[model samples]
Target: MPSRSGPSDAPRWCVLGRVPGGGVARGRVAAVEVDAAGERSAPIPIATAELPAFVAARERSAPRWVWSDTPSWYPRLLEAGVRIERCHDLRLCHAILSRSEAVPDRGPLLAAARWEAGPGAGEGEPAESALFEIETPEDAPGAVPHDLDAALEEFDRQRAALAACVDPGRLGLLVAAESAGALVAAEMAAAGVPWDAAEHDRLLSAALGPRPARGAKPVRLLELAEEVRAALGDPRASLDSPPKLLRALRSAGIDVESTSRWELAEHEHPAIRPLLRYKKLSRLLTAKGWAWIDEWVRDGRYHPVYVPGGVVTGRWASSGGGALQLPRQLRPALRADPGWVLVSADVAQLEPRVLAAMAADGAMAAAGSGRDLYSGLVEQGIVGTRQEAKIAVLGAMYGSTTGDSGRLVPRLRRSFPAAMRLVDTAAAAGEQGGVVSTWLGRSSPRPGDEWEELQARASLPGATSRDESRARRAAREFGRFTRNFVVQGTAAEWALAWLAELRLRLARLPSPTSAESIAPARASGPAFERQPHLVFFLHDEVMVHAPEGQAAAVAAAVRESAEAAGRLLFGSAPVDFPLELRIGERALKE
Candidate 1:
C-alpha cells in the first residue's frame, strides 16, 4: 500500500517512455528480478494500427500486462506464451487499475519482461536482474551499426554483472552495484590472488586479500567471468554527493572500493547504515509512486501530467509528464525531448513557510529568510543552540521526537500560546486518528466506526487486549492526520498562489508571436514575452519551460508569484516568504 513519501515506504516508479504528438509506453512495474522474464516474454500488441494506443490501456494494470509499439506485435506476442484477455482493453484497464482513487479510470501497463517482481525480488530469485533495450537515438535516429551491436551486447552482459540488481531496497547495491562488482574483480585481480575456477570462497578470499573469515560459509559461483572485464573507465566511482548529505562518517573520506562491496553485500559502514536503510525504504515508496505514474508513458503518448489548478490552492499542473520525485542521485536520467529543454526548479523550505503562515508564527517566519532556512534558524537565539532550533522547529512541523523541538515545544507553549495551542489541538486530534481539515473543504480521512469504539475503550481503564491494540492503531493513524493537516493544507494553498501568479505574470512576459507563443530567454535561447506557460510542478516546486531569451524576467515572475502567494495567504503577515531563483542550461543545481 502507498505510504507517505518518506523513509517509511520503499522507492516506487512508474517509468514512462513518451514521444511528442502524444504516443507512449508506461510501466508502473519494477523490472528488477524478472528482467529476463520481461525480456523473454513475447511482446503483445495492446494498440493496433486500427486503434489509438488506448486499446491495450485497459489491461495495462492487470496482474501484469504489456503493450508493444503496434498491434502487429500482438501476433508475435501470442507466440511468446503471454495470455491476452479481452478485459485488457484501454478503457477497462484504466478503470480497473487506477492511478489514484479519483483517477481510478486509468491503468498503467506492465513491461512484459519484468512480471513477477515487487519492492524486492522474493525467494528463489537471483539478487540481480535487468532490462536491456536498444533505442534509436533521437539525434542520430538510426539502428546500431553491426560493429556497435557486438559492443552493445557485451556492454549489456557486463551491465548485468551488477546493474541488474533485483533489490532496489538495498541502497548500497542500488547506487553502484555493477560498478562495484567490476571494481571488486579489478581489486582482487590486482591483489594477485590465485587465478579463479577454484572454490568460490577461496577465490574471493584471495581476491580480497587477508580478511577475517567466518567458518563454513556457502558461496555461489559468479556467472560471466568475461562480463567482469569491462571496468576501465577514466573517472572512478563517486563516494561524495555535492550538496552535502545529512550524515557523518560520509562527510569526509569515503572509499568507493569498500563502498562498492558494501553495496553488493547489502551492508554499509555503521555510520552510513541509517542512510542506507532510509534509501531502501524511500525506493520502495518511490517505486509504488512510479507504478501510479507509468499509465501515461505506455504507447508513447504526450499526456502532459496535469497539476490541478497548478498549486494546491489554484494552478494548472502538467497535463501528462514531469519527473517530480527526482532524487539527488537520479537527475541525469531525466532527459528532455529532442528539441525541448528541461526546466527544473525547486521551492526551498516550502513546508516551513506554510507552517509559518498557518500558525502566524512570526518568529518562525522571521527565521525562514531567503537562504537555507534551517541554517538561518541557526543564526537565531530563539533556542539555546542550532541543533536545538533544528529539532524544535522540525518537531513542531512534523510531530517528530528526540530533538530540541520535543523539549522546546513545552516552552513554545508557554511563549507562543497561539501557535503552540493550534498545533497542539491538531496534534491531539491526530493522536486520536482524526483528520483535521484545511480551511477549504478538503478534510482528512477519518477512522471508521469500529475505530471510534476501539478508541473509546482505549481511553477506559483496564481496557481488554483487543481494545488496547485497536486504540494504539487508531492513535497512530490519527497522529499522521493531525501532523500533516496543516502543513499539507497550507502547502496546497501556496501552490495555488504560485500558479496564479505565473498565469497572470506570463501575460507581461513578452510573447513575440501568437503563432507559436515564443517565451523569452536570458541569452540567445528562448525567452518569454510577457507571461511564461506554467509547464509543471512537483509537490512544492514549479517549473516553467519557456523561451530562453527572457530568463531574468521569467525568474522575476516566479519570485513575484511566490511573494504574492504569501500575501494572499498571510495577508502581509510579518514574514519573509522569498522564492530563491536558479537558471541554467539544465535544472539549477539544488
Candidate 2:
C-alpha cells in the first residue's frame, strides 16, 4: 500500500502513540515525524480532541503512519472522518518477521516478543488514551505498548529485520500487504456488508418453518429430526447427539462407521438420505438460524469481525459472527443498498495457477493461460476428463495418496514435472522435519518437540515397531500439512495483493454525486459513505457495494486489480488467474 513520493512532495513517516495522561479530560496526544532514513524530529503534542484535525491537515503530504496496531488506532480515525493512505503496523510486521525464514537471524525480533503479542501488550492500548478508543472490547492482557518510545523502538526493530532479511523486497511486500489487510479488515468492519434483515428472516422462515420461541426448536428441524429417527426405526433416538445417533444407525443395520455424510453416502439405507438432510439443516439452524439474524444484523448491515493473518497460512478467520461460515442459502440476504449493486468476483483455481507460476512450469502455465486450467489439461491429454484433472491437481498440492486422486497424480507429475517438483520438495523437507516457506517468505512453524522426539526414538538401535510406525505416520501427516501450506499460503498472498490493489483503485474512482440518486451508507462510516468500497471478502472472492453509476467501473477495477496482482507477484509469467465475476443487486451465487 506504500506509494511513491512525488518530486515536490516527499512522503513522511509519522509515528503516532500516546503521551502519558493523554486520556485525561483535557490531555494531549504525542506524535513524531520520522523520514524514510529513520531520522526523527521533535515530539509535537496535540490536544486529544484536536488529534483528528491534525491528522487531516497532515494528509496533504502523504504519510505512512507508524502505529503499534491498526485495530487499536485506525477505527477511531475512521470515526472522526479521517482516512489514511498507508501505514506500518508494528505489531503485525513483528509477527511476520519474527517467524519469517527470509530473516536469517530473528533474535532481536524474538526478544521483542511483546510486539508479537495481541493488541494490548505493554502499557495498554492507544485507545485507553482516547486518541484511538472505540466501543470495542477491552484490550487483552499483555497488550502491545502504545507509547511513543515503544512504538519507535518496535518500528526500528522491524525495519532492521526487514533490511537484514535474505530478500527484503519480497518480505517487505508481504509486510505491506499484511498491514494493508489489517486496514481493510478494520474498514470492512466499519462499513459492514449491506444486509436485508426482512429477507433473511423470510428465507429462514421458509427453510426452517418459522422462528421458534426461546428454548424451543424450529418446526421444520423437529420434523426432519423425527423423520430421521423414524427412518432409523428408533423413535427414541437422540438425533442431536452424534454418538447416540451412530449407535442408532448400527441398531438399524445401516452399519455406518460415523455420522458423516461421506460415510452415510456409501450406504443405501433409507435412514442415510434423511440423516444427511437432517445434518445439513441442523448445521444451518445452529450456525445461522433466526437467532443469528437477531444478533449479527443491525442497521440493515452485518459487521463480522475479520482477523487478518489469523490462519497460519496467512488466510483470514473470523473471531465473531461466524463470518467464514456464511451459508450459501442465506447469501440472498446479502442485498445491496437501494441505489447500489454488488460486484462479486472470485479467481478460478487460484492455487494451481500460483503453483505454476511459483515453479515456472511453462507447460502448466500455457495450459491455464487463457482458459479453464482443468479443461486445458483434459484437452492436452494430461487427464481424461476435467474431473480427473481437478482430482489430480488437488492431490498433488494436498498430498493425497489414495483413491482416485492418488492414481491420477502420477500422470500430472509426468506432464507438469516442475510444478510437481516444487510441492514434492516441500513435502520431502517437511517429512525430514525441516521448515518450508511460502513463495513470499512466510515460513511454516517448526515441527513440534514431540514430533522431534518421536523421530529420534525411531532412530534408536532398539526402537519398537510401534514408535517407528508412529513417527512415520506423524511425519507423513506433517508432510501433508507442509505440502498444502506453501501453495495455500502463496495463494493467500496473491489474494491479499489483489484486495489491497482493488481497495486503492476503488479509492481513486469518483464518488457518487447528489444528482446520481445514490444514498450514503452512513453505517459504513463517513470515509466510504457514498463511494464504492469492499463489503465482503472470503479467500479469493470479494464483493463491493457501489452506486449504480459506478458498478461498471467497480467491476472493471476488480478485474484489473486481479491482473495487476498476478503481474505484481509473478512478473510476466504466462500463468493466468481467471475470475468468475457477477454484478447485481444481490450477492447470489447463481
Candidate 3:
C-alpha cells in the first residue's frame, strides 16, 4: 500500500477506488497543472487509511475529489470527520454531459458506457442497504467500475467533454452543484430532521381518532363508514375497495366514473363528504401512520433518505419516508431540540422566477421583482388577481388550454411574451419529437421507441384518422411534460446551487457553545452535532437545525445563498430569487 505523502503545491484532483488489499488507492490526477510539454501528470496512488490526513492537508488547496459516486466515498470520509470542499462525481456528470445538447463533442462521454450505469442503492432503494452493493438495472450500461484506473479514465473523459462544450463555464457550475447536492443528500440523511414523536402521535390521534385495534377501523372512521354505507342504502358496503365503492356510489344515484376524491367532490351527495374524509384519513394512515413512525423516526429524528437527481427534470425524490410528500398537517411533529431552532426557508415561485431569468424577459422579471411574484404580476396589471396570475403562469408552463387556466394563459402571453414563447417553443419541440435542455444543460430524456413508432406509424401512407388522433394526443401529452421540464429542471438546478452554497456558509458558522449543546448527538456523528447543519430539504424548501443563538445568522446565510445562486446561474440578469423564511422552535404553525 502507498503511504501518506505531503500535500502538493500544485492543484490536483484525487480519484479514490478500492484496491485488492482491503484498502483503497488514492490516485492524484492534476486538476490544472501541466508540465513544460503541456501534459498532465499521471495519477499517484495513496493508501485509503491515510486519506483523512492527506485530505486535511490539501483542504486549503481545495482539490476536487474525482469519485465514481458521492454516496460511496463522502459518507466514510464524513464518518472519519473529514469534509471535502469540492468534487466531480463521474456518475452524475456522465449522466448530464452525455445527453447535454451544449456538448457537441460527446462522442467520448457517450462511449463510456460503464459510467452510464444507473445509480445503485441511492434513489428509491432502502437506506440500510450497502451503497455499492445494490443491483444495477438489467438493461443499464454496466456499473462504473470502482477502480483507481477506471476513475482516472472517466474523469479524463468528463474533463475533455466539458472542455469541448460551447459553454463550459455554466456546464462546469452545474456539475459542481449537482455533485454538491449528492453530498448534501447524504449529510441530510445523517443529520435527520428534528421530529417530535409525541407530537406526531397526538396529531394522528386528533385526525384519525386514536390508533385502531390492529386492522380494525378507528372510532371516527367507523362512524364515517357507517354514514357512507347508509347514504348508499348498503349496510355492508366495502368503503376500502375502490371498485366496490364505485359500484355503491352508482347504485346510490351518484353518477361518477371513479371513486377518486376530485370526481366525488364534484357531486353534492350525502356520502361524498364522508368518502373524501375517509380517503384523506386513509392516506394519512398509510403514508405517515404509527408503523411509519416506529420505522423512520428514531431518537427524535426523522432520517428520510433523499435521492438527488432522482427525477429526469433534476428534481429530488425520496426513496423512503415520503420526505418530499410531507403533509402540512404533520408539520408540528418537526420540532427542534431544546436549545436549538429550525430555520425553514423556501424560494417563492422559484420556477417562474427561473423562467423570467432564462428568457431574459424584462417585463416578466419586472413583474416578479419582489418576493411575491404573483402579487407583483397583479401590480403590473397583467392579471386581475394574484390567483389569476398564478393560474396564468402555471398554465403557460404546463400547456394548459382549457377552463380558467387556458383563458388566463393567453393573457400572460400578451403580457410576458418572451417567457411565454420560451415554454411554448419547448412544447412545440416536444410535439415534433425534439429534445429540450434546461438552463444548466440537463436535457430532457428523448421520447421512447414506442412513441417514435406511434408517430412513424401515424405518418404511414394508409394511416387511419384514429391513429393520427392517438399520435397527436400522445405528442400533446409528451409536449406538456417537456414544456414544464425546462422551467422545473432549471429551478431544480438553482435550488441545488442554493443548497450547495448554503451548506458551505453554514459550515463556516461558529459551532454551538457547550451551554447551547442541549440537543442529543446527531447521527451525522460528532462532526455536525454542534454545527448548524441542514436537516431537511424538499423541492424548494430547506430546514436547518441550528442553535438558537445562530438562528438569525443561519437565516441570513439562507437568504444570501439564494441571491448568490441566482447570480451564479444568471449573472447580471435582473431577476431575484426571494425566500420565505421562518425561524421557530417547531416547523409547524403557531
The candidate that achieves the highest TM-score relative to the unseen native structure: 2
Ranking by TM-score: 2, 3, 1
Estimate, for each residue in 278-344, the C-alpha lDDT of model 3 and write its tens digit: 8899888888989899899887888887778888999888877889988999998998888889999
What TM-score does prediction 2 earn? 0.94
lDDT of all predictions, in order shown? 0.40, 0.85, 0.82
In candidate 3, stretches whose alpha carbon ends up further than 4 angstroms from where it belongs are: 1-8, 22-54, 121-142, 519-526
Clashes of each: 107, 6, 0
**Model 2 spans with C-alpha error above 4 angstroms:** 1-11, 22-28, 118-139, 520-524
Q: Predictions ranked by lDDT, top down? A: 2, 3, 1
For candidate 1, write residues 1-590 as lDDT tens digits: 44445532321211111222234332111111113222322222222221223323422442222221112122222222222221111111111122112221122212111221211112121122223321211211121111222222222332332233332222111112212111211121111111111222233333333223343221111111111111212122222342333122233333333433354244334334433433343343333223323443322112232323222222223322243444443333232222234344567777767777677877666677666666666666456766665677667766655555577766545544566666678778867665564432233455667877888877788898877887886676567556666676557656655654565575555563444333222122212212244444565666654445556677878878778767756677776666655654444455
For 22-114, candidate 2 gives per-residue lDDT tens digits of 355333467898876667888888766676788889876878888878877777778888887788888878888999989988998899867
Q: What is the Cα-based lDDT of residue 335 in candidate 3?
A: 89
Clashes by residue pair, model 2: 120-143, 120-144, 121-142, 121-143, 121-144, 122-143
